[model samples]
Target chain A: MDDVTETDLQAYVDGQLPEARRADVEAYLAARPEETSRLAAYRTQRDALRELHADVLAEPPPARLVHAAEGIRGAMRARLARWGLAAGWIVLGLAVGATAGWQLHAWNSPVARAAPGIARQAAVAHATYTPEVRHPVEVGADQEAHLVAWLSKRLGGSVRAPRLAGFPLVGGRLLPGESGPVAQFMYQNESGRRLTLYVRNEPGSGAETAFRYAREGKIGVFYWIDRSFGYALSGELEREELYAVASQVYRQLNP
Target chain B: MHAAEFVALIPRLRRYARALVGDRASADDLVQDTLERAWARFHLWQRGTDLRAWLFTVMHNVNANRARALRVHSEFDEDAPEAQFRPAENGLLELRDLERALADLPVEQREVLLLVALEDMSYTEAAATLGIPIGTVMSRLSRGRERLRVLMHGPQAAVRLKRVK
Candidate 1:
């Protein structure tokens, strides 16, 4: 009652003061008419300002803002579509021997996109494999050392074949990549479930990062960059199993 | 957020915009620029974060840049004869008293007051939007209100007693 402050009154108006303190302010104001008049004027000012601007909240949002956002999103979609079409043509040109060298360079081109590009590479790899029984791999798991050495030379970085003890190694090989040479190590579990480990160098800067996972079609890719080599383990394996492979790959390459 | 989701938040953005820029037209333009930038950088957004805050941050930065350009333009035009105003036929306020009172406030004080009182931002939100701390927001809001009250009523208090007698 003897020591009320302006801050306390302002906090009361702002509904920030605790209930007990607010009650004290209210009691003090009731006994002091001059203080109450001042408080009333403050409240009147607040109300008038609110009245002046509150209606704006209910008004329609300006069309220009909406159009501006739509325009940007539309442009992004268009740009992505154009890139997708060019990629499809190049990837198609690769399957035919006439444009193999040029198409191989296109495949090895370093362009980062959301999901579709990784999915396309994975689909192409899957189609090339799964059918080959005799020559699915150039260097099989029996020669793990030679396979790793050959891929390490082609990829221009140390390469290790991640051991999937639970899943038997079917075979492995090197392929022409979008950015450079690529490696695919195929594994199959007792249930006839097959998984592919895809490796390529990220085009350009070679900034290696951690494993990234994306599921495209029946295949799940756990991709990561370690020492400038990018690896993607693609399969229909469960998320836990995929992480298990990625963890082993991360450990061996990193260690 | 999608374009539709972002579009829905534009009214609140406009309120903040209008509070930032005194003129409605300029505020709308600032908001438009903010929305465009937000959409372009939408892919860069990490999932499950406060989109409203992100939008406000963009709007605040864009407004600051626009304000800088405006300040430069105003500086060069300061001595130009056309820079002086004759009252237009269609100013929204009838009583030039409140308008004069608002103009009398320093720009910083005026900005803090409009952001809090008109835009209804909590001190934390206002601080974040203004790129200041919550304590500063409270101090600015309180000081701005105190100044506005003095400007609006100090002369009137003296005049009122003289007329009553």
Candidate 2:
């Protein structure tokens, strides 16, 4: 028989001993009344401890704890959803890349020549507006016609908000550009992520219509100059997502 | 694991905390702090492992840090007034004696004993939860149980014998 050590006795009392070792400990205890009484006392102690806190197990947890748990679960689900959206964007980028080789070709061209100053201004406007909670734009999307008319009058050209899928127009605000007033139109998704479209009158600037990308810190700008006005889309989004949105803006404005 | 599943373990956590801290308000506060820390670092917890053990480990660290901070602020008194036995209104006198005895055990030994005895954790789980070796856990358990027995019965019997003598 294995030696009935103190550790084994403690384990035996806690009901953690192996079945084979249990018989050995029991046989060892049967002959020793002193050990038997000690083991009984240990058993009684365990029972008393359990009985002392038994009421706690039956009580319902507090409301604050339940709410905190629910909040965590909600945040986790939001993270997973964001990941899913990113995966979908990757797949869409591949499909867009297949047909949009012209855009990829333009990607290699000198983006500095396209209009670096406009890209910087657009990124600045994005950074300023995206963090606003109460008033993201000067005029809300509820007055879309009035907002379009007002911005068009300020920028000296008729500007239209692009109807990007999944990004609803939040509104527009006018800001001072290097040479003139610029119209900044904002859009927001369901998750509250904001994207801004900056339009400034570039009457004398060369009409280079190729879509170009520039990054200012974390903000990505996809800017292009059409006939009379320069349009730049800025957002804190993946390059592909910004590119996709910029493409929609170009198609809608040119069409 | 899902947050609801984590919430489901609260009763067990509360029971263990109550036994460890010996008070309702402080035990619930400990559990609340544990939940907050656990959620903030939820990504660190690997899936498919024992979540209960992970939580207990977090609670052990939280409690230890609090105890350390508390000791720094106040004198370490074994017989502090708060540690005095408050008999439950309807609880038996013997159980009240047991509570006092349990409270009187050294914190290390008491934690190990409660994990093994009240929480019904295996020696391995208690060791893992407390971040101590299994051998240390065994020694603490042996010492704790023996100390508890003496505290519960020895003093009274010895005083009676001394009076008769």
Candidate 3:
């Protein structure tokens, strides 16, 4: 009786001890009132728990969760089809490679060429517009609200003109492009350097693509598409400087 | 298992899952996830091994993962009051209190306890289902039961001990 450990009492409560040992523990509990109380407490807790959760067995599970799981099973067959005879890891590797290849091809395109595209576009826009004192923009920054509404309407989805934090708004204009109507919002720093954000409805069938960087002439353009709407930030600034401005644009636009 | 076969096990899976998670909604999610995983990996289940044990193991692993995610996101902090602890609904010796108390236990202890008390799994079987040692299973169940006993009666020890005259 004095030799019994707390674990032994717990084992007895759990019904894990052999019958003889269990009987011995029971007898020991009978003689020790405190131990008996603990057993009673354990039994009550077990019974209470059973009462609480027993109905969960009868309750209907949510259809949505079950459906999602079913959907996964359905997709498994199709996934295996595209995987060919490759092992899971090999297939995963191939998938990663394919994604990288597609990304490289897309990123290197004119809309997303390395270093030249955006820079060239930015330089073109800056050079063409900055010298114009009377016609810097088709629409001035004074009509900011109307500019956003008009641009958003033309873009076929809601578009917010990005507010560049480190720079002040110069003016915005509507320009004809190979893509649909493009809205260009220009911002200037205290140093008189200009940045242009070009947004339009993606050309042709429209592509849902991620961020791509390109250099157009002396300008650098960082472009991305969300749904059918396309966004491009073009500037003659250095890569990091251009990116810093673009980051501000992205935050404001996304927010 | 095929789609039909997987669907058929849904009820039994839910029962075992409710017993494991101690929450109806989460248990249902766990069972659904389990069946999906099972269907995808059915071929990997060695033909000679116990299907019930294998299913239980998969469900156990999935629940463990969900528990880890819950810890990380802690998204349901608003429901934390009800998540790990909720009082029994009415006056009875039903399983609700047990379920709530079960939720309060750590993942390992709760799994062993449920496998033993509700699933009627032997220590060896529970161990195999958990991929743990039999001794570990014994220790967990022992500790879990002791903790459950304390939580169950700590508040109502006096009323529970009173006999009807």
Candidate 4:
């Protein structure tokens, strides 16, 4: 047909033309051998390009990409969990209000408020230092004895770097915290994933609590206060892995 | 939409990026940037819409911005398409030639071609992803395919003779 346009022919090659017009383009190409060959060439080029990069699809995606994807899932879950916590607090507050209105203030205790701060600080610290290639830590693991001693002195409390099974201590650093100096011990696994232990001297922070999780972007923090010192273990590792590492840190520190 | 759905598109994204960038590491970096931005702006994306197209749109913007920034610092002339796609010295392989030809295309043309040819995107989807009109997409596709053909196989004078009729 005289109406068969170049776009239609191109669409034909791409299989993008609507089914109703396909036969028309085929008939148009039947008379024009050159157009047929050109379309054929275009098809071949498409196939060659696909074939060339086909291996990329087969190759497993890099870990960082997966982590980034998982980060979105984690971030969303964290947001939902945060909303759930707030909803839970509201429900508890309402029940408490019905029983004794004056007790509502207790729910907003200083310790509950302080936990998030520690997790946020730890997450910020982890995000800041984990990406360093040449200098991930201030005091290298070789000087673990001095590193711990220096951190313990600056933090105004005795602190020991936890020996994680897969993650060897890369070193430790002292950072400015809301209350005072905070000690951050860095650890790196065989695959170059880094985790940090953030310890702050928070006296009168109340009784020890199990690991509480907080996520900031890609970084996840599992933090708690034990014996008046706030401890937050931060990493990009999954919750279970970080939890297991935090449990190890707790055992080693208390032992 | 769920992040799992986004994650599932990674393989296709990687394939498209690898073809688009012509280098594995840079391609992965592009995908990474794309995913990060998409994740950050996930709220803006409407549910039940084509997530793949939306992700590609994010990638297209990211890539265009990067390319613009790079052009400012680049020493070579981007318009010198002929100089860029010169055949390799050793004449190694046909696939390499195709790669070079694809790379040498103007970024706009290359994008349309890859979206249509490699990614199997419809003209409308490619247009939407690149934020161009569908007519522009078709024109770019036509020009890109012709240029690619010329680059891959020297000027087709014989084919042109039939067109003169």
DockQ winner among the candidates?
4
Over the stretch A1-255, how does candidate 1's per-residue lDDT look in tens digits?
A: 756666666666666677878778999889987667666655666666665545568997766666665454344454577678768777788656547777756654543453355446865796678567777778888888888898888888766777776777776788886667788888878887777777777666344432345676666766654445556777777866776776765666555
lDDT of each: 0.64, 0.76, 0.63, 0.78
Clashing pairs in 2: none
- Ten consecutive residues with minimal summed lDDT in candidate 4 chain A? A99-108
Fnat, 2 decimals, each candidate: 0.34, 0.51, 0.26, 0.51
Query: Where does candidate 3 chain A have its weakest 10-residue lDDT segment?
Result: A110-119
For model 1, state the Cα shift of residue A173 in Å.
Answer: 22
Clashes of each: 4, 0, 30, 0
- TM-score per candidate, chains pooled: 0.48, 0.51, 0.46, 0.55
Residue runs of model 1 more than 4 Å from their true location after superposition: A70-255, B37-49, B72-104, B154-165
lDDT of 4: 0.78
With a 3 Å backbone cut-off (N, CA, C), the pairs that clash in candidate 4 are: none
Evaluate model 1 with DockQ and give the value.
0.20
Question: Candidate 4's error at A101, in angstroms?
Answer: 41
- Candidate 2, residues A170-208, lDDT tens digits: the string is 999999988899999999999988899999998885444
Residue-wise C-alpha lDDT for candidate 4, range A56-92, written one tens digit per residue: 8888888878766645444444455666675577677
Please state the error at residue A35 of candidate 3 in Å.
1.7
